[model samples]
Target: MNNSFGLTHIVQFFLFVALQVLLMDNLVLYSTGFCFIYVAFLLYLPLTINRVWLLILGFIVGFTVDIFYDTMGIHAAASVLLAFLRPHVLNLLTPRDGYDSSDAVNIHVMGTRWFLTYAFTLILFHHTAVFFLETINSQTFLYTLVKVLISTLFTGIVVIIMQLLFFSPKRERIDYR
Candidate 1:
């Protein structure tokens, strides 16, 4: 990536973290759950980005969030895991040689069904890892499962909305060749 692209990514990363810490973290829907729209940063990274850089970026983003939430390293661990798994997940959803770096994974690029599946799978992975580590001692599988589901749903919705509202593709058809 060029310097401009790197700078843009960094700025977006901070904005996502700020949104997560300042806005989403405070908007509790229930007693013990809240949305985390910040994960969208990892989701929207260019498909062609280096895996190592992605993982590093994930750790930085998660650690920043951890600093804000005072939750130790849970977010960092989960974010790194999500970043590592992203390429695999995208590969599974997209055909060989069909990936498009210019496009963000969304309903417009991947179609609704694929986008929904992709988003939910990644969100669930992130939430599961986060809540599992958060509730390490209790081992309440059912409660953790519920939390993961609810939080993933809320976060996924917010991610989709933000992508639709703020992020726009260049409107050129990707040449899969």
Candidate 2:
């Protein structure tokens, strides 16, 4: 990728964070479902990004979100967790031939099935950690679990929609760190 494409990732990172704070934060359904769309930024990053940089980026995303939500570092924790687990999840879902450096993780490139599996797994875990961390009280476990599941389903669908709507095929590979 060219330097401009790398810069695009940074721009997208800010866009995602801004979208989450300014819009998605107010979009809750029946007080349960939520769209944590900022992580979409992480999901679409270059597959070859260094692990440490990925982790740091994740922390930055989470910290920015935490600042907006005023919920301390819950979002940061979940974002870091998602980043830390992303490589493992990629490994688990890798095709027998493995990923090409140019392989982009989007519905346009990876197809609906692979993309759905990838997004679902990561979002599920992220939501679980966020909800659980927010409420450690065992008595509210069922409510929290429902929120986690519902929010996961909601966010997954929105993320998919966002992918279908915004993620067009690239003429060339996009890389950033």
Candidate 3:
């Protein structure tokens, strides 16, 4: 990626993180309800991005969120896992011949069902990992599960909204090399 693109990604990541931590973190519906807009960063990555860079970006984004929430390394670990699994998930959802040259993943292009399934699966994985690690030694299995479900759903909804609102399709360019 060029310096401008890298800088833009960094800026977007920070903006999402700030919105998640500063705004959505405190905007709870029920006692256990909380939205996570930061996941949008992971969900919106280009399909053709390098896996290594994706993982690194995930870790950095999650760790940054952790710093704000004081959750230690839980978010970092989960985000890396989500990043690592993204390509596999995308591959499973999209056929080999259906890869879009633009690398943008959205309902308009990937189909609503496919896109929702993709988003839900990754969000679930991330929430599962995070909640499991957070409650490793605790005896509150049911409580943790509830929190995970609610938070995951809330986060997923926010991600979908932000994606639909702020995301745009990337233009496809031919490489004649």
Candidate 4:
């Protein structure tokens, strides 16, 4: 990545984290699904990013959110898991045409179906890890399950909307070769 790319990501990192802590965190739906839009940073990372760097970035983003939320390590842990699993998730969803390492993973590039599946899978993984760890002591598995599902749906919807509105891709075809 060039210096500008790195700087752009740095700016985005702070922007997303601030949004998560300042705004999204305050918007609670039915006292359940909390929006963790910060994960969008991790989700939209360049496909060629080093795994180690990705993990570290995920940790930084999550830990930043955790500090503000006063829930030490919960966000960090889930974020690390998301980062660790990202490559695998993308690999599993790779289109028959294949992926270009230079391209960003957004709805505009991957189409709506692929983007939805990719985003939902990662969001579900993230929310599951977060809710389960935070509610591990609780006896109600069903309640935890419901929270994870609702939160995943809410987060996924917001992510898709954001991509459609602001990050929509340019019109161009990606060659598998």
Q: What digit string (tens of lDDT, one per residue) describes model 3 on residues 61-154?
A: 9999999999999989999999999999988987767785654666566767878899989998898898889889578888878888898888
lDDT of each: 0.81, 0.89, 0.81, 0.88
Candidate 4, run of 10 with poorest lDDT: 168-177
Quote each prediction's TM-score. 0.89, 0.94, 0.88, 0.93
Whose lDDT is higher: candidate 3's or candidate 4's? 4
Instruction: List candidate 1 segments past 4 Å from native.
Output: 169-177
Extract clashing residue pairs from model 2: none
Candidate number of the best TM-score: 2
Least lDDT summed over 10 consecutive residues: which range in candidate 2? 168-177
* TM-score ranking, high to low: 2, 4, 1, 3
Worst 10 residues of 1 by lDDT: 168-177
Q: Candidate 2: misplaced stretches above 4 Å? A: 170-177
Question: 13-115, model 2: which lDDT tens digit per residue?
Answer: 9899999998999999999999999999989887778899899999999999999999899999999999999999998988888887877777887778888
lDDT of 4 by residue, 1-177 (tens): 677777778998998998998899789899888889999999988877899999999999999989998997999999999999999998998889788765677788788998898899999999999999998866878888988999999999999999888774663333222
- lDDT value, residue 20 of candidate 3: 82
lDDT of 1: 0.81
At residue 59, candidate 4 shows an lDDT of: 95
